[model samples]
Target: MRLSDYTRLLALAAIWGASFLFMRITVPEFGAINSAFLRVFFGFVGLAVILLALRCPIRFNGKFRACFTLGMINSGVPFVMYCIAAQWLPAGYSAVLNATTPLMGALIGFTFFAEKLTLSKWAAVILGAVGIAIITTFGEAHSMQELVFGGLACLVATSCYAVSGFLTRQWINNQGGLDPKIVAFGSQIGATTLLLPLFIFTSTTDTSIHWAQGEVWASIIALGVICTACAYIVFFRLISDIGPLRSMTVTFLIPPFAILWGYVVLDEAISQGFIFGSLIVAVAVWLIVRPAKQAEEVKALQS
Candidate 1:
């Protein structure tokens, strides 16, 4: 990867790491559905402005439906799931759970995409599951139910991410490929569309939404404009420049930044279990995603 690619990767990680903080701030006031809907709604608006500013035509090349469906899987569902998790899990805990995305990807690939699962990869999967169990069992929560549901919500979000990655490849990337910006914009449209009815329902039904706070709106805008809109643009560029494997390294870098932000900004306490579990997950992810040539060399040496 070029130096510029590395810089973009770190910037994307920082931006995304901060997204959990934003969600933590917004979900309580807006509720999960409303917070999620407003995020994509503003994300759509921000990306539209970006396209217009760049004079980029908004064409999906007959792939709008696919992009929309991808949005539901990738953006809409995952966003809501994470928001639900934010209600109970600390931002740091949620971020650590999200580190399991590649594990989920590996499992989904083996099961559904006919991808290979070597012995090492199977060990990685089992180790990743153990790491998740450790985090969920030990992480702080209001109750056991909250801890279980919160952890499960994050895993569900990551699974959606895994599915969407493949779908993006099959539907968008492999099928003549759309511009990343256009794909990002269209996906936000899809997310917004999917969440609108749920947002409306929650707005009508939930009496606890605290809409009068200015900081909540500020966090929401940052979540939409910076985290979703700008981060997607940079992430797509990284994929274009360095390929997905290298781009995936951003996953490894997010947790420390998230943990730091949680500690510094929110004053959340870090426990020994979080530290140990995060390390285990990180190691498991490396085992799963380490380059094929490197894995081959290690096996050859052992043989």
Candidate 2:
């Protein structure tokens, strides 16, 4: 990777790592519906500006439903689930748990899409589960029940992300190299639309929760513009420059940075279990994303 790419990696990791912290701090005031709604709404606006500035073609031509479906699974559902998880779990906890996205995808792919899994992948999935167990069972968290439930919520969110991978491959990829920026913009719009009713209901009935706080709204804007929108731009740019395999390596950096942010900002204690579990999770992700024999052969020839 070039120095500039490395810079992008760091920025991406930092922004994503800080996302959990933002959600943890703001979700109480914003609520699940409100937080999820604003994130996508602002993300759509921010992405629109970038697309317009760059003069990127934003085509819809028969892909609206596909884009909306991707948004529902990829962004909308997962955001709400993570918000709910944040209500109970620490920011660091959810960030670490988010690493399970690839693992969950591997399993879901095997089961639903009939994707062939190597022995290494099968073993990696089992090991990933063990890592999750270590974090929930041994890592510092709330009550055992809350820890379990919150962890499950994170798993559900990651699982949705996993499913979206297949959906994107089927719907978006089959459409002749669709621009990811367009897909991303469509997704934000879809998520915003999906959350409209919930946000409205939450705002109306949840009168007891205060909404006048400046810091809370700031966190919400940061979540949308910086974390969701900007992160996606950086991620797609990395993929264009370094290929998806290299870009996926960002998965390894997020948890530690999240743990650091949690410790620094939230004064959340970092324990040995977190370190051990995070290491295991990173190892498992490496195994999951590592090139298979066929891919390595193809890549060798291409290179």
Candidate 3:
């Protein structure tokens, strides 16, 4: 990767890593529904502005179903799930739980999409699940039942993300090289539309439109513009250059960074189990990406 690419990687990591912190802090002030609604609302506006500034074609040729479907899976449902889960689960733990996306993605691919799941992939998935269980089991045990429930919420979020991957592959990828900016644009709008009722009904009681603190506004803007809009741009660029597996390596590091940010900002405790589980999760990512590396090498050799 070039220096520019490295820069993009760091920026992407920072933007995404900080999103967990933002969600953790901001969700309490604004209810999850409001926070999620605003994030998507501002994200839509930010992307729309960028599209206009860059003179990118924003034309929608009536592929609303495909785009809207992906929006719900890729953005709408997962965002709401993550937001709700963030209420009960620690941000760092939520981030760690998300590290399971590739494993879940692999399973979804194999089961539904006819992608090959080799022995290595299955082994990696098992190890990753155990790693997550370690963290889930070890965290704040007011009751074992609560921990289990929290853990299940995280798993549900991961599954949402995983299924979204297949949705993206089948719907977006097959659409004659559709511009991802378009997808981003569409997804945000779709999410905003879906959240409209919740915003209207629930937000009236639990949410405040007034920004009491500048930090809150900053966090909201950062989540929308930097994390959502700019981060997606960097993400698609990385995927274009490095392929999805390499690009998605960000997932492994995100939890650690989220944990680190939480510690620095919120004085969140980092347990031994969290550390051990993180290491195991890292190993699982290495295992999953190994085949993608091999595939890239083979392609280079053939070329």
Winner of 1 and 2 under TM-score:
1
Summarize candidate 3's per-residue lDDT along 144-212 as a digit string, tens digits: 676677677767766766676566655656555467787778878888889878878876775345658
lDDT of 1 by residue, 59-78 (tens): 99999998888789888999
lDDT of 1: 0.86
Model 2 Cα displacement at 232 (Å)? 2.0
- Clash pairs for candidate 1: none
Task: Quote the lDDT for 113 in model 1.
Answer: 84
TM-score winner between candidates 1 and 3: 1
Instruction: List the candidate numbers ranked by TM-score, top first.
Output: 1, 2, 3
The true-structure Cα RMSD of candidate 1 reads 2.9
Please state every model's RMSD to the true fold in angstroms: 2.9, 3.0, 3.2
Candidate achieving the largest TM-score: 1
The global Cα lDDT (0 to 1) of model 3 is 0.74
The lDDT values for all models are 0.86, 0.82, 0.74
TM-score of each: 0.94, 0.89, 0.87
Better of 1 and 2 by lDDT: 1
Query: Over all chains combined, what TM-score does candidate 1 have?
Result: 0.94
Q: Return the lDDT, model 2, position 135.
A: 84
